[model samples]
Target: MKTESSAELTLRGTKTESRVELTLRGLVLGVVLTVVFTAANVYFGLKAGLTFSTSIPAVVISMAMLRWLGNTSAQENNIVQTVASTAGTLSSIIFVLPGFIMIGWWSGFPYWQSVAICATGGILGVMYSIPLRRALVTDSDLPYPEGTACAEVIKVGSGDVADKDSVESSGKGLKAVLVGSLVSALFLVMVQARLFLGDVAHSFRL
Candidate 1:
């Protein structure tokens, strides 16, 4: 028996065309999102040595923005999200790149050198992923927690998921994420403003 994946079910009847998927607007949005996310990723990585996945956020933002621009298709937003996520994720190179500066290997980043490094890294990643697509993503049963979650986000945004229960569950998940994000942002703002200490440390002998 050929078991269908949740992604197959969610993406049913959603294939419009490759032309729409590669529209000028979609490409422009993707580039804009890439710049935004890469900058944010570099900043966060350098500051805290941590970077969060921007895939779901990019998907959600793409869907919302394209909807506002007028009639939009899932394929277009897929391009937008893919570009943004790939660029943002790969920008983690900042983690190692900065070390060169810190170790006095270079005084400042040379623009062409950084560009070449990023381009080569991105190309190698794509080359490796092409071979692994079937073995890891298609044939394997390994639970991809983050990939699954991002798919659910896209499914809910697309509103064409075949399973009613899946749509409802994904909707709930999206709402939870929104509420949690708002609360966390508020708390962070308060902490930054010194409304309350974000951490407390006291030395005592006991």
Candidate 2:
């Protein structure tokens, strides 16, 4: 029975050509894009003294280009955008929130303690999702839009499709890389060496 079931599974998976291929491509591109997007966000975060939220935007733009080139499906684009956006928001919260305690923008919590709790919550979220995978993907007819998009991305990468029209702007990724690096470096320097500000003191009363 088990062997028969395994064979059935293999047969089912083989029937989907584009979906599997695209998903693999998406995963590969997703990793590369995540790094690039995170760096850009961090850089802009420092420069503007606020979070830039680049992850979603970057993914959307990249996927939109892919779709325009007929390399990705609408569902695939949606998935990448959702994942990227969530990552961007999470990254911003993780990176910036703890600093609030050190600077006294918030009170009644230790910075390290809050950081630990936040980190734990992030981990738990991932853990919680594992049990639901079957429910989300296998148990019902709910479409896995993000999963489908990832598959499409994989397919495109594996197929080695060329962008013949070259509609995408050149040097955009390079600009993001350069700016992000410079800003993050400067922010680190200032934070570590205390170049700009001292231990600011404050007292607030209601």
Candidate 3:
């Protein structure tokens, strides 16, 4: 038997053309996640000068939500993650554009200006990335670590694995998620209560 290529495996074993993949519920969930992740990215970018990728978290959240709904599918979760990741990535613009207003370059981020800048940048990015997708994702031997990890997540959550392995994996994933969530919640509480210094030190005093 011939082994399936990565591209083929990526496309196969899932419903690629199902209407459920683009349902109103899924779109709404995606939009909600997009907003949440975008806000989180903006906060972290401004505070730490860094932003985490929303792809993995979006995938896991989408999978959990769909699983709870009892009609989970890989395609639907993929769509949710795609939408959320796009919105989260666009939040990076917040890091640069606001500085212009602060330094007397622009009075403020005007509605039309912000829209135009984001739209143009997004379109140009998509245009440039098409070739890069072919070269890097399809042709190159480079290990796309994040993409590989996301694929593994999707596969594990796809429910195509053997029952025993699936149960074991799911249990571990749940435990990890719970621990992470608790830690994050605790950190947020500490910051809110001023129990921990969440912001960076701007000055040193003897």
Candidate 4:
């Protein structure tokens, strides 16, 4: 076995240390750049379509932006950008799904029914991906750019230096339960108190 002198060992250690620092720096910068690009994707999509498309292209654009702004390695940028972009894409899908009912597509059903379906679909999307994680991340090399981007955002944003704001979303089923209950109770109270009259006293002439 070849033994290295202490000086050679020290030099190698320093080189490794430098590489790690550089990698960290790249990741931090990539995270910021990715956020900017994601905002742009949402703005442009809303402008163009009055709705956002959750296609992979938006995230791909963010990755490109990371390269441009951070001058990081393509592989590193891809990892973070993929994650950030995917979040926006998935969120857009959740936001837009309910609109299907607005233009007469889902008219016959109560509005709350449409809302429930959308909320359910949003939750299901997350669950659906869980089973596919191994296949998508490992076996297929599917280039789930959005998933990669989302992971990156979480990793980067969790840092002390990142913004601390937090937001939570719930399914429409829960919302509907609350709102519907309130509305129904109010309606019942009004009807029972004779505050509002229905066609209870009307006689059909035809």
Best by lDDT: 3
lDDT of 2 by residue, 50-69 (tens): 66554434444555455545
In model 4, where do residues sit more than 4 Å from their true spots? 1-27, 50-75, 87-130, 140-206
Give the C-alpha miss distance for residue 126 in model 2, angstroms: 4.6
Candidate 3 colliding pairs: none
Weakest 10 consecutive residues of candidate 4 by summed lDDT: 165-174
Residue 19, candidate 4: C-alpha displacement in angstroms: 7.9
> How close is every model to the real structure, measured as TM-score?
0.71, 0.40, 0.75, 0.32
Structure candidate 1, residue pairs in collision: none
TM-score order, best first, reads 3, 1, 2, 4
Candidate 1 lDDT at 50 equals 88
How far does residue 114 in candidate 3 sit from its true spot (Å)? Answer: 1.6
Query: What residue runs in model 2 are displaced by over 4 Å at the alpha carbon?
Result: 1-22, 64-71, 94-119, 126-206
RMSD values for the candidates in order, in angstroms, are 4.7, 10.8, 4.2, 18.8
| Clash count for each candidate, listed in order shown | 0, 16, 0, 7
What is each predicted model's overall lDDT from 0 to 1?
A: 0.73, 0.53, 0.75, 0.45
lDDT of 3 at 105: 82
Tens digit of per-residue lDDT, candidate 1, span 27-96: 8888887887787788778767888788877777777667657667776777787888876668788877
Which of candidates 3 and 4 is the stronger one according to lDDT? 3
Candidate 1 vs candidate 4: the TM-score winner is: 1
